[model samples]
Structures are given as structure tokens and as C-alpha cells.
Target chain A: ARPRVGYFYSGKKPGQDISETMNNMKVGDFQSIPVVVREDVSVYDAISQMFLDDVGTLFVVDKKSFLTGVLSRKDLLRTSLGNQDLSTIPVHIIMTRMPNVTFCFKNEPLIQAAHRLINQQIDALPVVIEQPEGLKVIGRLTKTNITRAFLSLSESHEL
Target chain B: ARPRVGYFYSGKKPGQDISETMNNMKVGDFQSIPVVVREDVSVYDAISQMFLDDVGTLFVVDKKSFLTGVLSRKDLLRTSLGNQDLSTIPVHIIMTRMPNVTFCFKNEPLIQAAHRLINQQIDALPVVIEQPEGLKVIGRLTKTNITRAFLSLSESHEL
Candidate 1:
């Protein structure tokens, strides 16, 4: 008889029990540095920051550090080429606004995270902690992080 | 003056050219590994193989090594828990069929690859190459690989 995937009865199970499991999981386990910009920043500055940061996506936040929108490389390029004055405009003008942006919780399971990435069709999702009024952006969950976790999990089981 | 988000070239550039620009930019880069299993193997056996190999997903192939379906951990678990007789059943019954699976070409840019992951909501995609008459599965691209690429790209840009 071959070995089976042991039931994770102790720690976490996918679906309905995620919230409880999330509380148990450490935030550092899957955290990734987020690329962020201020709302008042110029589009050129945002683009330059993205290039400097080497990230395809950038999170737009207000002075309070609250997430307001997202500026992707594609979004920047399209907006920049569409306008006549590249240096005079602000990133918030062309950014994809809140409520439209998809995000995930910081303590989410890798499996659930994978599902979010697939279902949303976005490369990266901001990892946030829920507040009474809204969400607080903390880290990021990317397709790469999920893949690495999967690989590591698989390898550990093998060993 | 604030940097502008738009207005780089305030003229009507052809949509095709923008599409080309999007295609040219590399989104993520990483290597993929290929693993195959026969249909006659028990789900238990297959799971063990997956565990031993440190892969979350496995490609179910036929005697000719042609791609058939995919068996992921979640798929296996969902199927097994639903029926107690999974130990006797072959893996092919619950595996996702090839037509339903999304894949990528070797030369396709990372951006396109990332899009596939986002749209498909799958953690891993089998990388294939065009053959004379059909497509051949070469490697797999996963979220982990993409994340690694993103981080490295960021590091390189900083240097």
C-alpha cells in the first residue's frame, strides 16, 4: 500500500475553516514586499519607481497609507502614451480604483491564494488584514510565492 | 511639476503596436519540470509518487507519453473524500482533462504566461513546445517560479 496524503486534522483545512486557520498561521510565512506609491505622486515618478523597484504592479495609497488604487505597468504605459504631458499628471488619475482591485488576506492558505490568482486573472494580489471599516495592505501574494510553497510542500512530503 | 501618468505621446498610436509592446515586455521567467504517470496506477500510488517527487501536481499520460489529464492534490482530495473506494480507482477518472487545462509555449513571453495563470486560476501550467503536428509538454511553470523571477528582476534593477 502506498502512502496517502495525510489528513490535516490538526492545523488547517481548506474552505469554511480558513478563518480559524488563518489566525494560527504566521504572517511572515508567506509575506512578500509590496510595490507602493503615494496618491499625490506623478505618473512619471510612479513609473520610475516601478522601474527602480522592478515590479510590474504598484499599489497607490493615500497619505494615511490606505490603499486607494493600483497602477500596473500596462496601465502606466497606456496612460502615458495617451496623454500629452507625461510629467505633469498624477498616478491616481489613471490608476484602477479601489473596490475594483482584488486582494487577499495575509494569513491565507497557499491553496486558497492559488485559487484567487487563477480566478482573478491578475499576476499579483495585495495581502491585507481586514479592519472594521476596510482593509489594511500589508504584503503581497504573487503567483511565484504560491508555486514555491507548493514545491516546498511537495518536497517535504517526499523527504 | 508632478510627473504625468499619461501624455508620453498624445497621438493615436495603433492598437496593434501597443499590443506588440505589451507582448515584448517580459513579465516573469522561470524553469519548469515535467513528471508523468500512467492511468492504471491507483490514486494512492499516484499520490505517493507525487509526495515522493515533491510536486503538487502530476501529468497523467498514456503509454505513448502523450498528455492526457492533470491530477492535483486538491482534485485528489476532493475525489477521495467523496468516495471510500478511491484506493481501487485509477487516477484518470478524477483528473482534469487535457482540453480543459491551459498551457504555454516555450518562447512565449512571461507576461503572456502570467496572464494564463491569472485567467486559468491554476497554480501550475505545463509548458509545451510546438511539434510538427501537435504540442508536446516540456516543463511546468508555477507560481513559485514566477515569484522568484519577480524578486530577481527587482534585485537586478536595483543593482
Candidate 2:
């Protein structure tokens, strides 16, 4: 029997332009939309939000809506156990701050995005849009979402 | 039926120990081993090696094994389209150099690793282990592998 051809490379409408492949993909195509929280928010509130959202990570942003830091579930737990009052303490105090925090643009290819995650040994990344001043927080890319996209793509290829 | 417990809270084993928890976790685990070709290797030879290894990405390293640059299948294809004499062209001419490339350490947390991949917008990451002089490449983490790990963890949680 002949090997099966992947659906991704299969025939498309005659008018479809192949060079525009990336355009068809969206930011949501490979990233998990992380639950974001403001820097001033209490650690207690952030934990609750994470539990409710069923996500392992959260993006910490500033008043200007720019990404400031990231807070992982482990980080929150570690800080909470260290005698810090979750309710009284703001997320900014414990977050992995900027310069230390890494991010990606929303328009980038999924393959490129995945490479960054594995190379950096990071679980979650803030998705931003390039602005004249800098970058604006728009979404998030998580390990969970990347896995989902990979599986979906692989399955499509198998078919 | 009881609600499915998530991986974070699922009690597979007893007695919570932070050190043990960290040790058992495998976020920085690499699925693929990275292979590098020297600057003197012809692009044709590099492409052949990539195919023989069935890898999508290749690192171009120097004699010291220090990562100098990277080459991807897409990059090769584009380069081939412009030059037919790729057999004589060294890979260094078309590779994306070190300063422009992103990478990760073996000790980084999974959340951080995932975040970096998404942020950098790349597909494969070179896993490095710190040595006396500098970092040495140990393994490679790919989107496919991350997806597999995530799905497996999620499935285990569901079970």
C-alpha cells in the first residue's frame, strides 16, 4: 500500500496562494491563552484566579498593559509558604520580573515559538504585539497549548 | 464519578518533599539529540546529514563544539532555491548566527522552558549543560516532544 499523504500538504482550492500559509494561522493556533493579572493584585487573588482558570501560569502586567512579569503556580506556592501574606502581598513582589522575563510576538510561526519554549526551559510565555514604544501584552503561550497544537498537527500529518 | 484531579494535585506518591518534587519533574528533558556540522561542511553534506538523522533543525558548531549558528530545513530550501551549487557552499554562509539564536539550560523549570519557546518563536531548542569553560550541548527539546510529555501528564492525571 502507498504511504498516506498528510492533510496539511493535500490539495487546496485552485486560487489559494501557498505563500500565505502563515497568514491563515492565528495567535491562538499554538498558544494557550493565559489568565493575566495586574501587578497590584494580591497573591491570594492570583492563586484563586489560576485555580479557576485551570492554568498553571499567569502573566503579570503593569498599568500600561505591558508585560512586567510571570508567576507560576510553584512560585506562588513557594512564596505563600515563606510567611508572606498572600492577601496583603502584591504579585509584582514575587513575579519573575522583566529583563528576566522573556516574551514572543503573536504573529510569529508556531514552530519558532515552540523552539523558544524548549530552549529557555520555561513553561509559559507572554504573547505581545509590537508597538511603536515597545511590546504590548496580548496573550500567552503555555506548554499545554503548544502540546495540543503539536498533537493536532501530527495527527493531521498522519492522516 | 469523582471529578478528575489535575496533575499538580494528584497524589501518586506520599509525603510532599520539595526537593524530591523538583528532582522527579522532567521539564528540561530533551527528546532529540542535537547534531552540529562545522562551518567547513558543505551545505549539501549538511542537508544529507539532516535527512539521514531525520531532523528538521541542525546546529552549526565550531571545532570546539561551541554553538556558532543554526540551519533549518526551511533555510536550506530557500538557500537551495537561490543557488544550485549548494554542494560547494559551506553551511555557515546561510546559518542564523549565535547572537541571534536562543537556547535553554538543562536545569530550568518546565514552565520557564515552555515560555521561552513560545516567546522566541522557534521550533527546536538546544539543551545545554554548564561546563567549566562554557555551556555544552547535551540534548534537544522539540515541540513534538513537549506535546507528548504534556499529553502524557494530562492523561495520567485523568486516570
TM-score of chain A of each: 0.75, 0.76
lDDT of 1: 0.62
- Candidate 1 ranges with C-alpha deviation above 4 Å: A1-159, B1-29, B132-134
Worst 10 residues of 2 chain B by lDDT: B10-19
The lDDT for every candidate, in the order shown, is 0.62, 0.64
- Per-candidate DockQ values are 0.04, 0.04
| Per-candidate clash tally | 17, 27
Per-residue lDDT over B1-105 for candidate 1, one digit per residue giving the tens place of the 0 to 100 score: 342233233222111222222344343246557777887887777777766776667888777677778876556544433424555879988899878878777
* Highest TM-score against the true fold, candidate: 1
Instruction: Return the lDDT, model 1, position A108.
Output: 58
Model 2 clash tally, residue pairs? 27
